[model samples]
Target chain A: MTCATRIAFTLALATTALVAGTLAQSQPPARYGLGRPATGDEIRARDIDVMPDGRGLPPGRGTVAEGAAVYAARCASCHGKDGEGASAERLVGRNEGDSFAFATNPKLVRTVGSYWPYATTLFDYTQRAMPFQRPGTLVPNETYAVVAYLLFQNGIVKEDAVMDQATLPKVVMPAHGRFVVDDRKGGRAIK
Target chain B: MKSSRISRRRALAAGTAGIVGAALPASARQNPDTTKVQGPPGREVGARSPFEKPVRTAFSPARTATFTPLQDLDGIITPSDLHFERHHGGVPAVDPQQYSLLIHGMVERPTIFTLAELKRFPGRSMIRFIECSGNGGRAYRLTTPTAELTPQQTDGLTSTSEWTGVPLATLLREVGASPKARWLLAEGMDAAVMTRSVPIEMANDDALIAYGQNGEALRPEQGYPVRLMLPGVEGNASVKWLRRIEVADQPFMTREETSKYTDPLPDGTARMFSLVMDAKSLITEPSYPDKLEGHGWLEVRGLAWSGRGRITRVEVSTDGGKSWQNATLDEPVLPKCHTRFRLPWQWNGGEAVLMSRATDETGYVQPTTAELMKVRGPNTQYHFNNIRAWQVGADGVVRLAGGAA
Candidate 1:
């Protein structure tokens, strides 16, 4: 074969190989094909997490008045009659005028109002793990009501204010913007 | 002081005498010759020798934090049963056959993998350490500081194990995780339904959904059936008895992350997602409660680990922080795992202070207690990886520095 023809054939082969490699790279990964597709009902049953933006919150409405009753009946025993901390952590009270002195002052109490960055977390944690004895038993309405009661006691929301899927996420917490991402990067610096 | 020393010597003599006499049970004291009698047949399950008594201790009255006996352990792997446990909800007896993990949210195919199906994936095993961010806080914070503190009591929330499981990236890929997905929220099935939001970068990195630990099925206390193991991250973020994982574009701001795990800073701003454990080391031998019989050529041993990378060096300071010497690191010093360090010292029986500091591959040196406190403030809690000082008295008794003997 002529030298030019031989070079042309080699160039064609290399071009084909590059195209094949690109195609293979673009193709989707070969799945193990082991697990089955989850049903909608199954996903819904366990997808109970509520985001800061109220994404996973179920439709429910509750008022401070209703929450007070629920707290007395179900939560007051362990959480204290006034949420002043009994067997569990204190859920009430916020030092309104005091500066954020938790890092320096040992006397600062971290309650739901003072430290929690999101109000929706109250509903999420209460419904998922509260009453200490019986967890995941509270209905959505009860969870909302108890959250409202704690918020009210902590001087966050007004007594007549209602807490629901829409309003709970909108409740701006005092500690909302007080948090920063981790800055320590494991260097010579102590921090 | 002389009378006390004499009494100690008398007590030691009595202990030696009792070992061959009344201290032992009748069966043990009489059956000195094992070759004279036939041994019992092997059992279905095995147990540790009755004479060997290593136990875990609950640090709190609520039994929320069960600590591993660090002083009693050697090498790296913690016995599966004795691994440290911090359960928000109590251990749940999950049936392996019925257990399933649901991965849904921003995925091409939302799927459920049963325990049996998860085992079918190409498995990987790794030796890694999982440390609670709060480990060593008591000593570093100087709260309830005492010379009587053991290595276990000071820092026992960390444990190492050979975990066998599938990489979380593989599982996420199998589900066709979306390119835009930046976070995944892992939820546990315990009564607390413990949940934590993990960054997607970590998920696609060295994260493992572990099932087998130390060559056997995980104990219930260590999350039986299945659990997420984020290498080098805080233990709480691993999410034991993992039930669900939801891919998301933003963090869920779960209770654990927002209200509990976040570290409050001296500047009035709290730091969240402080997951990686810093490099730290402490001499386990010649620590509190371990009295030396005599001073001579003795080997000082301890463990050093880092979440960022392999422990590049461990420095031992026999003269309180004035001078430091590098300790020899044991072999198989894997990244994100415990590396044993040793040093030989000639003790002159004079009063001395002993301490160790670790430096990781990232060039991060474990800070001294004063340095750490200066940066983090006296009131901040968690991630206390400060250099620990052990004081050796003239009588050869070791204790925590600044602590009363």
Candidate 2:
């Protein structure tokens, strides 16, 4: 056979194989195409959730002293003067090692010091909804301050430790080591 | 002569009437007034008879929960208005014309769907029960006297209804969810902006964007315009008044998931995102505060359900936990829906402890309060589903057991 003819035949075989592979990878479309596609601006306005790893932490910084002041002015009315709790949930307690020991006890109060596993959760929850009456009103810095103060109250961080996107996630909660990922599938096993 | 005969006949009739009246009880006497005529026709919108109105009892002042009157209901389906409610924020009155659901994040096409546009998709309906994780929390309190407790207060956070809506999978597919998407953050429109992280697999399985309940438009309290319904999971996961769903590769770790619904364990480690409510059942009839009267023949009735699947078996224990007998489950035992169970009991009017245990399709048996505390510890507040014991006294009073006698 001639060399040019042999090369042309090989090229045709390769092209057919490529076309078949493309067809095999395509999935049947189930699109109804009913709603309009959302724009970038529309998504940005409502994508406000923060993760445990601090992936969505906004740029802000606050000290424990600043957080204390913010807590007194806004959070203390509901959470109590010393975070002991009044009308709302208590935010500070000293039951570090014994929090789970008293799990069934109604008097065994849960607080940031004893129960919460992630410090980043404080910043996320407070920024999203706090001050009970007027939620989402606090600025990012104020939210950081409030979180720093709560952590300090729980003896989790130093009073002067600055809480920002970089350091906040690093502040390991005392209860962090205690939590186990949920292993219970629907079954008779207790765990 | 005619006057004398008439008097004798009248006297005989009067004597017969007196004898009959004396033999009958006062309540059994025929009422002349009620037999007069039929009453007026009903109003345009039908109303439950004044004597038959059953209402929910609110536990908290914020109206955080309005418990269903479980004992008063006959079948599995809870009336739209009578269904139990638990809202982080008060129900908002939403105008359907202005409502829309926004789907974004981790998707090839992020879409904004109007209520009308959402309804245009092929819809599905299923009978399912939505139960708060805190349904049986009150039963854990050992201080409250059981005599004062009612079944409604103990296990009323659960209610079953036929929810109608577009499958959430359809919406996610239509929006073209990215291959990396693993979770979706469902956010509500209430003042609290209640948010929950739902696994994407559940959405693909049977989760719904429910817009109708019990053959009518969704009730205002049940998220009138639209709500996300994750059947068999904790009620909180089925966010009400849903406005947006953001697909993500990781869970958002919202406050509800992190702080509130998470269950604490004996090892000091809390269990996060333990979403599926296990097999649980409660005997509604012959429950607390209901007297047995003479206790000859009592038809014991209750509800059994599981988030995993259908209730396979419900066992009734008349002699406490010592012995268990299988109860008859009503027809149409649906998955993630309440299944009614019945049993016949011949009470001898002596002291007894009656309880029920539910086993679901996955063979998961309902744990006792003691067994639950052994693993979860006494401090764990959420997801308390344990076998409830009703202690009957010789006086025919039935009260919940494990509380102040």
Candidate 3:
């Protein structure tokens, strides 16, 4: 080994050592051995959140026809006779024709069809908190049917469409591409 | 301390007088001089003085919300009972003995911790403010355009408390959170089964899985037994009655984060995950319903806070926004916590307008409603932290003015 080659090798070793030391210091501390390991059944029972990409979706199927009956029996009293909204928020509206004019016009209402960015969110929300009085009462198929009815009323889906786990996620929302992540970083911008 | 001593002396004098007055007829007991006699013995639990009444104003639907009585409160730490509350489902009664928290998904070892086990971990106490993003929406949107408003009615959805809990970082390490995890779905055990997607950075930061508030077991309304406390984040994201957390690579896009909490923009795009609250201050005193008594010299008092960092300064304008003067910030102005501010004003029995603006550590000055409307438009549903204005008439009556009106 030449003298210059030996020097290069020594410098490389020092750099590697420095990097390794920093990585070790940055790693999380050792666990405190608290809390028991969760069983698979317990995890599955509580892990009910469904992501936008269809993860965590339960197996179920429902048609628009089935949804209409469920909507009248369960949702109409609060959401209105035709999902036009009464005591609760309006659930059906596609006004303004894709203009996204809600920001400029205060009178324009934000209904599920015109504002919601994902169909999966509709299902996720309905199954978790619906009927306003008795939330989490809707079975998987009822949740799917109610979602299909809402989407159909909003003019996003056809009356003949059958919504299941696969198709529910694939149903594109009108407001799908209208959301942007928050960009304000707390320095002088009011936004 | 001096004020408390004076009040005690006055009460003693009143009690002495009541002794002489207590010898009246039995029929006179309708307005009994109870101070003359021995008070009731201590019981298993205590209650507030019956004469001191400060109640929360609850809105409709029974599940909507209740506003704290900000005008009746003093100091930075809001009493646990008076803390503002917003619930999707009416507060659920959960048995702490049967409660457990599940942390799973994208972790080397999924774990479930009972309330007792969670308390066994090292504990940390912090003074932080939790605020509803829609706090001042009624005033900001001019929906309630009236000068007849109290501090509670105007902006009472924010409150501070000394929260004690185990750090979320400790729990994450216990579960061995995987490197691929970028978000966690926090789910509650309420009727609504409330859920929100919290960024992983917050878990690594100062997040807490709190079981205690103001040195007592959590109230059922405040998520008894357990709750996920993300300091400086919107209250909705800090899921209460916390039952489960699922670590994931991306946001869950829960209904709260998407259809509910998103802020609409003028550019036709609603902002998702707009979490951190901006600098805001409200002049609680010398506002509507608080009349000046002779008005030789009055001190204006209020609270200022920032989600990003400490409140660096609070500016007061006596004559609307035409001129400004720096107000004195009270001691222990902790970061991401409420900071009390005050300024002395001399009113010569004339009409004047009062306002306050807070500047945070990041040099972000609190904006007016007009300035915020210029950027985000008037329809942005949440995070309404704008300057408020109060007008004092020559008749010594104060009223809400300018900003919201």
Candidate 4:
């Protein structure tokens, strides 16, 4: 190789190594942004997480009796009057019957009370994502009301059971054990 | 950031004012629908082919995407006109002269760039696939076929393009993003006022503010003037007719992200924002309406992709779900890009089912429709990325098959 070409080749090699090293030094992608080294203010604004332990629970309260009224006003039409998975997602319901493993058959199926691992995911997702048209429009109280109504529909909680910041996070759905965080091909895959 | 000079080679692309995508040879154009397509014989101003030219059908308002006769396609890259389209409301008639892109929020300079300004930046052309997360959702039920799934249930997303546009990072830099900017709020111009929040880091990584599609200015259905192109992420997040770019400290928790894009899992919780369509493969040939005519020499072709990464392999099955074989995957297996795969089969003239499955670089194997049903639950409506099956009846007609279709 010519002198200039050799110098260029060496420089290119050095750049590749530096880039690779930098990427390798990064922290593991903490699941749910939970373990990531996030500051308190950043967490408050960006996290939007409602932990199952009720740690991140906002200062709010809504009785199931009160929630029914809230659900009728802010949620019913799209999520079904009772959260029974209408035109929108089947927010409430458990799928019974066979679970699959290795079966390479093609089909699409999923519901709320079957596969999800964390309840916090449900709350976090809803707070940041829902109400197909007017998202993030719900306040903390409304979110609790909707969550309570949904749990009632799934038969996990009694219709009259009031769900507040203290009680909401502790109410675990039955299938929580069924979900193994995808520790399959990686540490993320909970095989 | 180099000097802008029109070279003879780039003139057709840059033919010194010739649009970069207008590089098609204007001559004897080929018929995309026919078995044997012949391009413009030569030296004709309007000559074109499927690769660089699409048959433009006039419309009160033209559709953003056209469907390829699944029967006619051999490999991936549906003839541009034939690619299917799914847009909210409808395609808007955008006047490029009035188009402008506003880039603001958490940036050094909250500036606006007109369509012309964006076009002046250096451009990169890349081939990619954008399948709806739920393209084939209803394949799980076998007993009650039509009773469970509708025709519209299939193919909710379609089309692939050799897109040419400016990298989103370039624009972000020009605007000077602040260190705190983490997510970007993207909005569309359609009636739905389509909106979604994307991680700004992704834009800085490989996203693009595309103004061109398949070698031309934006199609009306596609976001004309400009659209956000986040390769490998979910489709809805790539807002078309992109109107606003607000880089912020966190995701805005928009409607699309909250109410629509998520899939409810089985355990009384929702699988939220499960973006990046899992790896999937489907045979375009020998599929619905494509008759084999009592079996003979048949060449099987299909498209495969993954949001996680490049497709590393594809396997085909002919004897129901009992046996399988690897197909030839066309190279340059680009990440978030469509990879065409093919296989040859001699039909025995009996009842048989054909299917293809793709595996991506991340080793996330494409799940059969049945396997997916197990993980997500049975009431799925969105983000259904599963293997597809095409049943070949004895007489030669093909229909979506059970198990994997």
True-structure RMSD, every candidate? 6.3, 12.5, 8.7, 12.6
Interface RMSD of each: 0.8, 2.1, 0.9, 12.2
**Inter-residue clash pairs, candidate 1:** none
Provide the lowest-lDDT 10-residue window in model 2 chain A: A96-105
Docking class of 3: medium
Worst 10 residues of 4 chain B by lDDT: B1-10
TM-score of chain A of each: 0.83, 0.78, 0.83, 0.62
* Model 1, residue B185: C-alpha shift (Å): 0.4
Rank candidates, DockQ, best first.
1, 3, 2, 4
- Per-residue CA lDDT of model 3 for B1-405, tens digit only, reads 111111111112112233433554454466477766765588998876644456677656463788887766678999999899998888989998899999999999999999999999889999999999989886687644346676777788999999989999899888999988999989999989999999999889999999999999888888998998998889999899999999999999989998899888999889999989889999987766766657476678899999998999999999878899999999999999999999988888888888999999999999988888777787778898889988888877777785643
Q: What global local distance difference test value does model 2 have?
A: 0.83
**How well does candidate 2 match the true structure in TM-score terms?**
0.86
Error at B375, model 1, angstroms: 1.6
How well is each residue in B355-385 modelled by candidate 1, as lDDT tens digits?
Answer: 9999999999998877777777777878888
* lDDT computed for candidate 4: 0.63
Q: How many Å off is the CA of B391 in candidate 1?
A: 1.0
Worst 10 residues of 3 chain B by lDDT: B1-10
Q: Which stretches of candidate 2 lie over 4 Å from their true place?
A: A1-29, A96-108, B1-36, B143-146, B403-405
Predicted candidate 2 versus true structure: per-residue lDDT over B1-405, tens digit per residue: 111111111112112233434554344455436467555577888876433446677877788889888877777999999999998768889999988899998888889999999999889999999999988888865555454567787888999999999999999999999988999999988877889999999989999999999998899999988999999999999999988999999888777887688887776567888899988999887776576766477777899999999999999999988999999999899999999999888888899888899999888999888788788776677887888889888887777888321
* Better candidate by lDDT, 2 or 3: 3
Mark the regions of model 1 whose C-alpha exceeds 4 Å error after superposition.
A1-29, A96-98, B1-26, B143-146, B403-405
Candidate 3 interface RMS: 0.9
B77 Cα displacement, candidate 3 (Å): 0.7
lDDT of all predictions, in order shown? 0.86, 0.83, 0.86, 0.63
